[model samples]
Target: MSLEGLNMLWQLVAAVFAGLGAAGVGLILRQLSGKRLPRWIVPALGGLGMIGYQIHYEYAWFDYKQAQLPASAEVVSTETDRMFWRPWTYIVPLTTGFTVLDQSNLVTQEAGEDRLVEFILYRFERQHTDMVSHQTYLLNCDAREMVPLSGDNREPRYAELRHVEGSTPLFQAVCPNA
Candidate 1:
């Protein structure tokens, strides 16, 4: 199984444990109160604990993933959004995704007059299931153009080629000497 799958499985197990623990607390409370607490309180507390754990896990994911990255991986940008379903996000926007540039694997080449740099970009998104995708890119310092390379052959996707500003973090990281 993929790391994400394993993480999800662990999360499910943790939530179940949280619910069980909260239910145990509820049982103890009832016992101490001469059984005056409603019979539904135990299950209600269990459900609350599970939901609380899920919320905390969702909010903590970005920081957890960031801490897992290598030293060479620099976060270029982050995306935040407020979802209608997640009302609390409107108060404090949730980090939905981020882009990381791997500096260690950068390959610089001289193709005649142009300075070409090939690098990998890692994109991480928070969804129902966390997703991570990476793609190889070729950047021409002289032309300030960037293009994604496709497949094992590493052929440039001309259709997706676009201009990149020199001041962007990606450009600065890949073409610092340019």
Candidate 2:
């Protein structure tokens, strides 16, 4: 789905959550206003409820997006950053959500008699240019490395090719799934 569409969906969900939260607060205010509770406490509780709903949606945003992704999609990269809160003094008041640092579609290639499959993830940030590299190997379930390849950045051209022989063409197709 398009980014704009996903964003609109999230906005709608957040609105529903916010409305429910505010309505709950209003109900509680009506119940406690005549009792021992002070009149100022009603608005304070409502404000806190709204803030709580906002925080909940913010933290769940990443998970909601991930759940909507296609099964074939692979999350090759992720990032999280710290955020600050002023008045809300609950725990550290810091929140985190995964930024889809990078994603890729698994492509299978046929080279001569051998088959080459690669998961190529590309990240385009707001910056003019950025690069990333990783070391990959076809290992077994026991965590033994096989035909390890050095990390290489994808710039003007793909770095180097390192191939290892195995009993079958599909070697590293194990639990980890890389």
Candidate 3:
């Protein structure tokens, strides 16, 4: 299995242990105090702790990936959103999605007399159900501008051309050939 798959498996195992540990503590407390604690309370507290840990892990996922990335890899942009089930997400925003670019793949291409940096875009999502998408682009090295190309047609599409800005770090890194 891939490293990511292993990481996910470990996270789940840790969560189970955390839940069990919390439940054990609750049982011990009840016995020491000689109080008439409900049996359901231990499992309930464990369930709550497990859910909290899962939320924290999900929210910090971006940072975890970043930490695993190589020095040459950088996060270009990020997208955040909230879900109805995760109400606390509104306060501590979760990185629901993001784009990353590795400078190692930078390439130079000639567009007639002009030299352009061409690279691929890698989009990442927090949800396992979603798949990463790759799109191609060409950057004018001197102008610090870029235009997206159609993956199927292998041609430039004018609809998404723009200047290099703080939001375009992925372009800056992957298209450094320009």
Candidate 4:
């Protein structure tokens, strides 16, 4: 299992505990209300709260990661959608998939004066179970650029890379030896 898998596992465990805690709260509320609440109401409310919290966490995951990630991290790709079940998502889009690259983990090479950098790409998909895809790439970081290498069937899609601010970290981190 990868770090992301471990993170999701921990979230699942926390959700269960949160559900139970909500049930406990319901019990306390029932007691405070002189048991006017029906026996099933407490369990029902707990279940709803648990599911709501899990949904909220999953929906907020992209924003959470963006906030927590290092400044050197770059969002290479992203997709969003309006989930019908979550009406609020109609106004605010939800990330269904994304790819992020960390500048710190790159290898460098030089073709004469031109610089070439190799690095890994981490792709994430949100679904029934969150999934991660890993690939590698070799980028030529001169005024004109090309991806000389990449893992799997994937090739680099972004051609106007040199103009992006994120490319600064990428070039700096990858071209230190050059």
The estimated TM-scores of all candidates read: 0.78, 0.48, 0.75, 0.57
What lDDT, from 0 to 1, does candidate 3 have?
A: 0.78
Q: Per-residue lDDT of 1-178 in model 4, one digit per residue for the tens?
A: 9876898788888888878888888898899999998898778778977887777886788887678668877876788998788887788788888878888777676789777677877787887677788767676666434453443665665663334233454455555443
Q: After superposition on all CA atoms, what RMSD does each candidate show versus the true structure? A: 2.9, 8.6, 3.7, 5.8
- Best candidate, lDDT: 1
Q: Write the per-residue lDDT of candidate 3 for residues 1-178, one digit (tens) a residue.
A: 9877887899899899889988888888878778688788789879987887888888778887778777866778899987778888888778988887766676787778777877776888877644578777888866677898885766888788888852356645654444
Model 4 RMSD in Å is 5.8
Candidate 1: regions farther than 4 A off: 1-6, 23-43
Please give, for residues 129-173, the per-residue lDDT of candidate 1 as tens digits: 878999999999999999999999999999999999989888999
Native-structure RMSD, model 1:
2.9
CA deviation > 4 Å runs, candidate 2: 1-33, 86-104, 108-118, 122-178
**How high is the lDDT of residue 161 in model 4?**
39
Q: Which one wins by lDDT: 2 or 3?
A: 3
Clashing pairs in 2: none
Span of ten consecutive residues with least summed lDDT in model 2: 123-132
Best by the TM-score measure: 1
Q: For residue 2, what is the lDDT in candidate 4?
A: 80
